[model samples]
Target: MGELARALTRHGIRVRVVAAHSPGLPVYGKIGDIEIVRPRYWWPERLEMLRREVGGLPVVWRKYPLARVQILSFFLMHAFVTARYAQSCDVVHAQWTLSAGAACLGRWVHRCPVLVTVYGSDILQVPRHPIGAWLTWLVLSCCDRITAVSHALQKRVVQLGVSPERVLVVPIGVDVTKFLPADDVHRENLILFVGSLIERKGVRYLLEAMPQILSVFPEYRLVIAGDGPEIISLKQRAVELGISRQVDFVGFQSQDNVRVLMQRARVVVLPSLEEGMGAVLVEAMACGTPVVASRVDGIQDVVTEEVGVLVSPANPMELAEGIRTVLFDPIRWREYSYNARLRAVKYYNWDIIVPRFIQIYQSLVG
Candidate 1:
């Protein structure tokens, strides 16, 4: 959201980010030319702060009636306040179904067109429930324009009864200059995985592939980055597989650290069961690293033979083979690396993507 705000501002459009008030952030702040506001949603600010940190609302939602009321209260307050504030805006652009649900109500007041962007789980998980389905459809039916980050998501929105004409596929782009290839390649025999250590990411399958990967080349090491609910279980799995020593768990690193790791690895692997667009894959490619990812959903759209190898999801042997294909052969690695960087620079750079967004905003605001 921060990146989008900054990008929009750079293109000469002002953006105000209205979101839940977290513990550390100020109620109001500024980033570049963008304004950020986080209004209070509940009483006893400390409890709200704790809920933001540890997901306290969900804990109480299962048993407490007041917690259920708080959820509705939060949503209602957000919708009312957002519409009130957005009355003077040219357009209301909301990202994800929940935010769209809130922003869609702006039509009742300001009568501005709302651009609802469906990304990943909002379109995937939200529509599966009865209430969530109604809420999502309410936003989709009310919004003036709709955008998704992937073709897969665009199709899903259409399946949900949204008109095809209202939808656009405008992927989130990477900063090519910030994540550019290294001046000199010092890549090790390392296979890097950057994402939350969750089951959906297929991290366990990747760990299962390690023994076979190590058998081919003893020097090869696996570095898993990112923190999530599955991190502890993943560590236990590594120990059970007896490849714990070869695997390094560097929990959640910054984007800059990720860029360095991508450039320094022989291959970046993502064996996800599902994906929206796999922006992480593009980021790795931008750093001149070849990918070994699953051929599932939108991940297939990003990885190709020119940049990386694609294997079926949940197949450790195939993933191991794909990793071997990149890391074991220096000639092929160089070729894939060159092609990856070329593709990233040519297509997925922010320089190329921001203009597309500008065009969309102009058409809507006009």
Candidate 2:
């Protein structure tokens, strides 16, 4: 959403981000031309723990059961604020289903088109439950247009009874200039994994594959960036596998650091059990780094035989083999790197994606 806001502002579109408040962050601020307003959902501010995790409501409901009460306040406050802001906006563009639910309320105040973007679990996992299915259907049905991050998601949305004509696949774009290849920097014998340390990310399987990856390329090391609930267990698993020396858990990284890591690493890997579209894979590709990711929904839409290897998810052996294919062979790695950069520039760059968004907004407003 940050990228989208900046891109829209660059094109002279006024963007105001209204979201649930988080601790330590100001209730209102601005990043360049983008206005950010984080509405407070819960009272006694410290009790506001709903938006703390990477997975949002689902994770909060499953892990911190007591924190689920905040959902009521979150929904009420989010909808109220969204409706307040809707009066000034031309279009209400919500990023996820939950956000769309709130944005839909804005129609009561200002009769404008609401665009719902389904990224992942909101359309995939949430709809599996009876109550969630009803809510997801209600939210999606109420929206004027829907955008999905991948073709896989578009098919799923159509399956859920949305019209095919209303759905379009517009992936989250990456800044090619910020994450481009550093030809002057020497590539190291490092395998990079950048994402939350969550179970769905399959980081443990990456750890499980490291020993095998080390057996062949002893000098190679694995760098795990990002932090989450799975950190302690993942570290323990790495220690148990006796590959602790070869794996570096560099907690969380800023965007600049991630770009540098992608540029320097020989192969970037994301062995996710499922993905919305694997923005990390596109970022790696933008850095001219070949990827070795899982062959799962959304991920397959990005990775192909030319730019990267896609192995079965959750299988350490297959992950190891995929990494070895990129690490051990120089010619194959170079070919993958070249194609990866070309594909990223052609398809995933922000330069190419922002215009599509402008068209969508124009169509609705016109």
Among these predicted structures, which one has the highest lDDT?
2
TM-score of structure candidate 2: 0.98
How many pairs in model 1 have backbone atoms within 3 A of each other, for residues 3 or more apart or on separate chains, i.e. clashes? 0
Per-model TM-score on C-alpha atoms: 0.92, 0.98
* Model 2: lDDT to the true structure: 0.89
The list of candidate 2 runs beyond 4 A from truth reads none
Return the lDDT, model 1, position 140: 91
Q: What is the lDDT of candidate 1?
A: 0.82
RMSD of candidates 1 onward, in order: 2.8, 1.1
lDDT of 2 by residue, 1-366 (tens): 788788778778889898768877788888887878899877778778886777556777888765778787787788888888788889999999888888887678877789888889898888898898888888999998999999989988888888899999999889897888878357998999999888899999999999898999999999999988899999999999999888999988998899999999999999999888999999999999999999988998899999999999999999999999998888988999999999999999888898998899999999
Candidate 2 deviation (Cα RMSD): 1.1
lDDT at residue 271 of model 2 (Cα atoms): 97
Best by TM-score: 2
Over 1-366, each residue of candidate 1 has an lDDT whose tens digit, in order, gives 666777677777878888777655677888767888787777776655324312123234544566666676677777987888788887888877766778876568967778887767777766788887777777798888999988899898888888999999988788888887875547777889998765678999999999999998999899998876678899999999999999999988998899999888888999999888888899999999999999987787789899999999999999999988888777888899899999999988877887887787779888
**TM-score, cand. 1:** 0.92
